[model samples]
Target chain A: MTAHAPERPAAGGSAPTAPAPGRAPRRRRSGAGGAALTVLTWAIGLAFVSPALWLLLTAFKQENQAATDPPTLLFQPTLDRFSAVLGADFLPYLGNSLTATVASTVLVLLLGLPAAYALSVEPVKRTQDVLFFFISTKMLPVVAVVVPIYVAAAELSVLDNVWTLVVLYTAMNLPIAVWMLRSFFLEVPVAIVEAARVEGAGLPRILWSVMLPIMAPGIAATALICMIFSWNEFFFAVNLTASQAATVPVFLTGFITSEGLFVAQLSAAAVMASLPIVVVGWIAQRQLVRGLSMGAVK
Target chain B: MSAATAPARRTAAEPGGGPAGRRGARAAERADGWRRRAPLLPALVFTLAVTQLPFLATVVYSLRSWNLLRPDSQAWVGLANYAAVLTDSQFLGAALNTIAVTASCVVASMLLGIGLALLLDRRFAGRGVVRTLIITPFLILPVATALLWKHIMLEPVFGLVNFVLSPFGAGDVDWASQYPVLSVVVALVWQWTPFMMLLVLAGLQSQGGDVLEAGQVDGASRWQMFVWITLPHLRRYIELGVLLGSIYVVNTFDTIYMLTQGGPGTASSNLPFYIYQRTFLGFDIGQSAAMGVVVVAGTIIVATLALRLIFRTFMSAQEAK
Candidate 1:
């Protein structure tokens, strides 16, 4: 396992060291075969991504053009549907999504960072048990508890409130954040921490001034992963929220019954709803693997 | 943070060396322990409050004969709901569907992910662009992905799937309705394959070149190297991918909801969706709660195995450094 460590850098750093010599020699050995493989890879990539690309294209097409048999590839693009979707009651749901995602991420960071710090830097007793407990909650299917959550929320009069979503989302993402952040915290050298302690730096000061700057990228990566999951979460949003605090996912539920009608409009709405996370995910692609793997890989 | 004051308090209380000093020292040590634990309490408490309390309520709800529509029909029916859930054919069917969906989705996506990871393992023109393209499906909102497949790709007359297959003499097929489970699986595979690919790609990239180069120096064929060396090296990664992927995919709801609604009559419904239907649509709170308990019990069996694998992977990685 230690042998694999040197090849795995921190997230968002760069490609692994193996790619340099590992591929160059192979390509040199079989140039034609490699070229054919590249082409095949490109073809498969295009085909695999075609659905998403088609969604984008349909978003820019007229309703009639969007659902053509041959799929109108060269139609005049338009933003009518985009404007139309936005002109509808889309902003409120978008706002709710933003509130839930941003607030929950912040909450997770606040709560998880300290917990991760305890688990890693200070070395809490039975740290493994605590960590296991956190992650095991993740294994508890949301469906199992949604009924009680709904009933409880109703009793508390917070059923359709954005804060309810915020709290739930925080719980949902906290385990991942704690695990990911703890891995990052572990990467902070023990020598540096010991030096800080020698200098009479308190735990809060050391965390705020010294370690935060070093693991900033990792924290951002963790936050991005949290945002992705929170934004994409549908079950809780759909079941819990109503007109007042429905998130973007709940907004999309309106399309479920629309069925064959408004293909272009549905595409437009889907594009807008998914665009933020899609771009963030693309930019943070390297970190995404580490986050999704709970930092087990890198 | 609170550890700063512990030494001060200790010295102020205990002077020299005796039983009293020992007691003071023990008190200070306990305080230090509490300080270490303080940072963890908020998250632990919040997780417990938000997650565990409801689950406990669900247990309580399971034992009661409660229906939302019947305001006066609430009473204790200990284990009756569980009996009904175990015997209900729909619940059994849904449990089976959940297994099938989770198993097939994880296995298929993992296979595709490995293949894609291998393809992208090498240097190539526009590799970054290609990787981004492959990953876009996963980035798309799951709801949107479901809608895209349902409306834009799987709709019979004008859908792109049949149109693309038309050249091969395939006729129009209403995919979501005709083959609900397959349709859901196709969309899930598209979305999840990228995730598996990324994990496998990480694994491939982490392979030490020295070992592979050693294999090459020994005149090992590429296929021989992949089978003998790369595949074995990828075992842990593949296991991690399958476990993590099943964890997420088993809770699939948005895809089934937006694409098939677990239909043509619960054919594609997994446990989550079925439990949701019983609770919300059927308004059978007690029965759904029972089903939820059953699902959790089943998940515990699988998750215990999964947790062991995950812990092994994580611990080994930690020990690696």
Candidate 2:
């Protein structure tokens, strides 16, 4: 019964506001407990994050240093690993990743926008059912159809093209993109759209001029998540690509030649491969959280 | 880009004029709709042409007697390929292994996610950084994750895990040879548990503090609160997470491909790896297609169930509200 937090009084229509009750004083008393709770929270958080920190630290050390007798924290730092990783066919892989990721993301947004708009503002019958249909695509395992996909790719001679990935990634990422963007579009306040329509503005015009700017942050977050998913995708990239079209992850596999696994070089490749996404994640961590949480925090 | 290109073409095709063009405008709008839908057509056509065509072809092939080794000697031997796949011990083992590994990974990750989410739910300093760090695993390339576990951490002597254990008289253990399935399961859990945590945490935060506070006011213990309220509230999310997570687990090839290659004696082969080996390595294209068909059919059934369950829960929640 207490679950309902008085819903945001319907947009632009102000409900009579009431003064604060006993909550202001209660917050003052809870401050000390909140601090302790915060510490416990951070401890739990750090414990969870330790694996990633270790992975980063391991990246900086030599292969032998990483596999040391005691797992050495102090190490002879070297840029040679970085240089070696950089000097490989790393750039082309990076290019492939960029092309596939950017293309797929843009494609998803383009197709998804109209679909979402039609589903929302147009009040199409069974829109929710249609929405559910869209989301259901995420349920099937890609590998189930992967063999067929491979055969298809080969037959079409799109074996390693970034465009092949672009298409597949678009489909793979479409479900979630549509799901997320639909919710965002729904939240854009239909009355405003109607107002724009009343003023002779069309749906596309309203979407471009009025709705998109307000929803830019959410849209960016969705695109970034799609980008990450596309970038990290390996099974398809590995199978579909051989030499000319391999992504960074595929190139990273070169470290495991028949001569045996080159642990040092592989680690270097991984570190370099993950750097772009990691940096992006770091800079956009705030936005990532915001988008991922579906604006629950706000 | 193809999808985007569709709309631009539609707009370009339509010329805006005054009231005289109003009737034409509606017709153009209809034209534009179909045109805009066209761009998505190639993508869909490609998906159907590739994935669907091969799928149907596989089904047909499954009934025929065709060996990749002698393509010219292929014959129409109805149901022999199916009988072969059904009777094969490797297929049976693979089916069982696939079920066991997928189940273990899903259940373990869900539990770990719950534990992590519960711990991370409290208001705290540095929570943002920790949150980002925890999700790092999900972001790491799967091949790299597999390689790290297979070569660096799970190596018998020098691997960090073994080195730490060796001091306690835990002698060198070949992960693939000694405990192949468990090794694959662990690697998968490591990669996927982060996903569950992320989803579950999002669910928990969205549930918010009010009902929890009310439960506390009623003198409910943490156990009672979770059992009576929190769990029910999170049921939909857990279902969604489990469903998506299972999809990832079942389809996973890179981990098994890189880590064990389903090897040391086919100990770690799941459906995907089984299909891969049968088709590419063993050159049993017909049987591989059969295996691929089975995997796809199985996945479709499982995914349908998961989706229905999750959707049913969501509907009930809406009704409750």
Candidate 3:
């Protein structure tokens, strides 16, 4: 779980060279302190996680007891809540979310890869300024652009279309994709690129046949983070999409109906909507830490 | 070997010393410079087209008075819309609320995140599981986060919070009703604390073992180690978290929208929600665009300062370890 460092290849050689004789004293000194620290961490960790636990419990309880006064902890488990949320025209919104997320992630990669390559490999004269400009685009709040974009979309007769959302998602994720990919690209040994260059390869050929192959894992990590961000995006999806392109978040928001039965259903829908991303996060824990930090720590 | 037999027209990137014997190489270098920028142009231009053009159009709209509901009533107002937006009571309230939400959420989350990261820095059983559990909130969907808080956790009557506090006879208090802004801020803190935790955790883990051992050998107290050594190394990372967290929290919309819809009469209306209400509900296109321009201006100022700090602190000392 802790091994996301780019110097991972060196660990194999450095492992046995460490001071094995000093390990016993280190372990002895940590005996009591470690026990107390472990218990404290467990307490705080569970406290932090109680919310998700509450959501899961709510998802399984009967509707009448889901939000009962003082709450009901132990109740008969039921699947009816899941059935309820699933019954509501929810699948289409899920599909729309998937389409926009997948398509936009792909588009960001298509455009961002070469840009990252240039920035890292054959940087322009003012590479930092260009990178700053890219980050600047991301810093522009959604409200600023949404106003004019809405007007333009209305003028172009393309409001409320999924394809429009595809475009919005791409713009929203592109700068971040470039920033992250550039950092990942920088971690590749410059010596390898020089070797590739010595083989009489042009820029495109080197990127395609050499850099891409070696950086496949980095690219996968980048793609996963992009997909996660796009999937969880709310502001653009909610504003740009209404009927035909409303994503899972918009669908999940429909549960504000405040009926007795809908509370449990809301929990069920929440669980289903969030399960995939949470699992993805869990599986890619190390890469996620690197991506979240923009590769600063890694 | 390459220099002897290869082409003499190497670019400036070839690093030949003193610009000595390369007449053709200079021209080639200049041309190569422009050529190297080719791969970056498409993405750059595409981003500009999609992002900046709309902002440009917004600037134009802000200068003129336009109403989506009454298209024919449009007329050039110059800076009048900006004047109105600046003077409006709701805008002031929303602006203050946004600052409050952002300041509180960032400060609280960063503190809590640092505490957790420090606690988990040691090797313990089930360390991976504990870290995963703590970081789970950040992975949940935003709208779902709002729902989980609004309905299931903080709803006053039927919430788990009340249930947990029921023994004290204070369980039935309606938190959302009493503290609408704080309610949303707390929920946001819950979601973002993990983000800060993850970043700061990486920073803590990255501390050099040799440096730490030297500190211990020098008979430094744990508190001294933290105050002098640990804190200095973590400043840039903490600042990075603040910058990123502020950017996200400033535009925090979904939670307020779902939880209270900015509630009780602009009590919880941050800038984004206020802007939403203006354009969609009031259809005051000019005023909303004006507010958006103000937001963009504010963001640029903050971003420039943040970038300078991050770059100065981190990149300059890159090889310190």
CA lDDT scores, all candidates in order: 0.88, 0.69, 0.81
Q: Give lDDT tens digits, candidate 3, residues B1-321.
A: 111222233342466555464655676677787777898998999899999999998899999888888989899999999899989999999989999999999999999999998877665678778888998999999899999998888887788888888888874767777889988988999999999988888777666666777888999998998999999998878988998888888989999998888988889999999999998888888889999999989888888897777666445433342
Give TM per candidate: 0.94, 0.82, 0.92
Arrange candidates by lDDT, highest first: which order?
Answer: 1, 3, 2
Candidates 1 and 2, the one with greater TM-score: 1
Clashes of each: 0, 0, 0
If ranked by TM-score, best first, what sequence of candidates would result?
1, 3, 2
Superposed model 3: Cα runs more than 4 Å off: A1-33, B1-27, B317-321
Inter-residue clash pairs, candidate 3: none
Against the native complex, each candidate's DockQ, computed on alpha carbons, is 0.54, 0.23, 0.54
TM-score result, candidate 3: 0.92
Candidate 3 lDDT score at position A217: 66
In candidate 1 the C-alpha lDDT for residue A152 amounts to 86
- Residue runs of model 2 more than 4 Å from their true location after superposition: A1-51, A126-129, A257-261, A282-298, B1-54, B67-69, B313-321
Q: Give the per-residue lDDT of model 2 (tens digit) for B1-321.
A: 122333454457577888878778878777656643443344334434444555576777666666667878677777677778889898889889999998999999899988887766653456555666676776777777877777667777567777768779887887866898998898888788777886676566556456777887899998999899989877767876776677668777888888888877877888778877776667666677677666667767776777777666544543443
Model 1 spans > 4 angstroms off: A1-30, A258-261, B1-21
